[model samples]
Target: MRPPVEVSVLILSLSAPGVFITMNNIPALQEPLPILGMGMVVLGLVLLLLLLTVRNLKKVDPLFYVFAGFSFTCMVFLTNALEQDGFISGFMAFYLKMGEPHLRTAYAVMTSYWEGVVHLLLFLTIIHRMFRGKSYRSLGLLWAGSSSAIIVHIPGVVIGKYGSNIQPAFWRNVPFFLVPFWAASLLFSRPREMPVVTADKIIAEQKKGLLSRPVDLLLSLLLLGAMAFSVFRGFVVLDCPLDACFTYVYQYEPYLKDPVGFPRVMMLVYLFYALPLLTVFIYGLKTPGCSWMLDWTIFLAGAMAQTQWCHIGASLHSRTPFTYRVPADKWWPVITLNVLLAAVPALLALRCHNNPTYFLKPVPEGQTINEKKKN
Candidate 1:
């Protein structure tokens, strides 16, 4: 007999595909077919990856693997239903079909609810492991970040809104800001007795080197660019009037009947934001003792990508006259790449048995490193 988890995942997967097929009908029937098509293509790829992961559940983090598979299934199903039927139709269908509407309202609702569950679980896992023997500093960083997410996210939930209206984009992104904030805090918080070399030791040499002046400068520049773009977008959202000379800027306005330009710009923002994380991952791969970093980074990237994917899929399904620019089929490819990218690190993390140093460092004295490292 198939494992209980596998059987559950299969059921969820099958239910979701039907939703996806239906969701596509909404946007496929709209104009700007290419844009919608690309979106769907990306979405489909993501679902395929999740389905594959379910088939290989033994290789993934039990909590995350299950959540990921279910999350994608929910999204595809919701999107399909929303696109084919109206919002109420899709929402009711998934609610009744999946037997979990109370857990989440719509496909996007399911995605957000599960995503929150996953993050909380990850936070707990990190904390549990850290308490076992890992550094308080790393745990502290995660705690701070996760706590920020809770703070920012709770307001949105309480207010009963999904997107930026509950918490503006700037406020919604505050959790991500915690990473750099914590990094800076480390420099000041390090105990006088702690050696600088140990910090270097924790990270891979390649990453250590990449965090040097030039790389730091590049990161700073990127941050600044992101901030500037955010400010610009914020201003536009606020409806700050433009002078005659700035009339060109108004051409890129976001509140127009057709806001195609806004999404395109937002896509650019996502790409830029993703770059630094990607850079760090590349650096980790080259670092001697930094394999764990690679795993963590991969997990984070996948989670983040999944978050975005959920939003995009939801947006396509909304009843607002706004363009349903993304086609249904496109989502598959994007999700597939995201899963592969994330799985590498997750498998590595599991194989290392939660030991960050297993692949890079020799076993510690008196115990096998992996066993010793278990939380």
Candidate 2:
């Protein structure tokens, strides 16, 4: 069986002793959950049919379906949770039912609330926006938040299913895994409209001390350093030798050999995160008055916020392999630091984007160019 989620070692978890890590545990139900799986199946089919009947079906983007599919999965899990029996229907019920063959970690249980309840609502909001042709600014948060909640959980299920003979109720996860990808094609087919700027909508909020003087400069420098560390971490993940990275990485940090799931995704995300984010921060500092800075910061904030959440969540998750667990000695420091990585960007984004005038170089009042007496 795949050992429970917890980062116990840097590269040694594969052979580390299994010890109880602090994860939320779930108890197994002696009997099947007190509900019918088939009923939900019928409801899903009916919802799909109803969606298909829309008059503008041709104009409907596939992202809608991705949203629908994930929402459906969320609903099914909600059913399991609400029944208070951890039961579900269709193929997913087998993997998701409250008991063994599942990791039964708190993260797994929380997924029910995140996917089944929160994601369900978020998808509906996104769909409402899509239909209304609203700006995607709000969508930045929705997409990242939902992605964080779900993406972090994926490696857990994958390792559980493949590492062990655990079924994972794979059928239940089909739409959750595939829908966003298919929808991405549709999303990128055209250029996205940027948020409209009202030139220098400076407000008292813009004068907030956080965005003034040395504070902004210090924060930018700090963010760059953090991103640099993130890049180094990614390198380690992509196979930087332990001897080369030992000084930086905890001795007990887990790195699976040919690691799959969370470790793999993390390495890739770090590479993506490292350089561009640093460049963004640099560009903002160098061109303090740049208009595009606000938009970039906002989007990056969403991306970082969720990424760190997923990273930390995966590390603490019960399904995490023992070999990969963060040793207890470094747990608080590591987890707390990652938490900071998420927070700094979010706060910066809020300060910069929420008030467009927050970072612009203010012109002196009553200033106009003096006319030169030239002949």
Candidate 3:
């Protein structure tokens, strides 16, 4: 049996921060260190603790080891945040220089905060539930999308603006990028947490068109608007010389033109990736049997949440050059637009999850008869 929740919490509390703080105080540790040695020690210790404490750890999903090990590395993320904020120093300077010099960017600092605090807590919750043999598919999918977005834009900025500065330590992100795809496949393979509705109910829900579902109709419109906005910003970043794109890029979201390239790559991600998804979302809303919406919406919601958080925060952060920041006159409008971009997918996900009958597969006439007879 797994340990009680309190025991797990207590163990983590003592292990993660305790080790980090102790190492921070060591003058020798503060010096430049080999990334390989540090990574092995952190992951090895966490894996060792799990082996000793959780008896059934091996019997549980093997992915547990992958996630749990990654979770402890949130300490590195925390270290990044602390070092950036000046609460601690030197520990990560060598690693950042050798691995990802772009870590010094404003967007990366905000990304560190998100990963350290929010994503760390999320991983812990997932680990706790997994320890107890509970379903963590939903959370897994969310993290999959969130992590995928981070991995994409982070690399995009590095290649787009800092290509010359790339280092071997940067290759460490290869696993971080790949793990999400593997975890997502595992999560999607799990049966969905669908309510046990009758065939009749599924048929009735699926029969209704988009207009009949006022909420879905509204959501579809919002998604369309968001799609347009995504493409617009994408063009703005690409230097589309149209009057509106040119004017808006300069006067409104000047951050899109930031030389650092994070915002530019972000908008392109939305355009190329999110735009197609948004189009499919509208189709899912109008059509029946699009059960994929349930998972993808949650996935997109997570992606949008992480993407917009980094984009919005980094754009206005004091670290961003003032000339590239959103103009004061346009701050509210610009923020509102970006906030809506993040929020719409989340709302769509909630809609699909809350009343999934519409997205549930419609029963064939023969199956409905069989089910009726069985009932």
Give the least accurate 10-residue stretch of model 1, judged by summed lDDT. Answer: 252-261
TM-score of 1: 0.35
True-structure lDDT of candidate 1: 0.39
Which scores higher on lDDT, 1 or 3?
Answer: 3
For all predicted structures, in order, the TM-scores are: 0.35, 0.58, 0.89
lDDT of 3 by residue, 160-181 (tens): 6777777655666777888888
Estimate every model's Cα lDDT from 0 to 1. 0.39, 0.51, 0.78
Q: Write the per-residue lDDT of candidate 1 for residues 1-375, one digit (tens) a residue.
A: 544443444455446545534544554433333434443564466557655635653343332332333344334444444434445443334222322222233323534544445443444454344324444443333333222222223333333333222212123234334443444255225431121133234433324353453543453444344344435544443445756214423332212112322233333333454445545544544455654552344334433444344434444434324333233454464335434433443343343334343125433445443443452
Off by over 4 Å in 3: 1-33, 56-58, 88-90, 364-375
Cα lDDT tens digits, model 2, 130-249, are 666765444534354345434545655566344454332334445555555444444444443433333334333244453465757777777887777677677776667768565445
Cα lDDT of candidate 2 equals 0.51
What's the ranking of the predictions by TM-score, best on top?
3, 2, 1
RMSD of 2: 12.8
The list of candidate 2 runs beyond 4 A from truth reads 1-69, 76-114, 124-136, 144-212, 242-244, 247-252, 255-260, 288-296, 321-323, 358-375
Judge candidate 3 at residue 27 and give its lDDT: 50
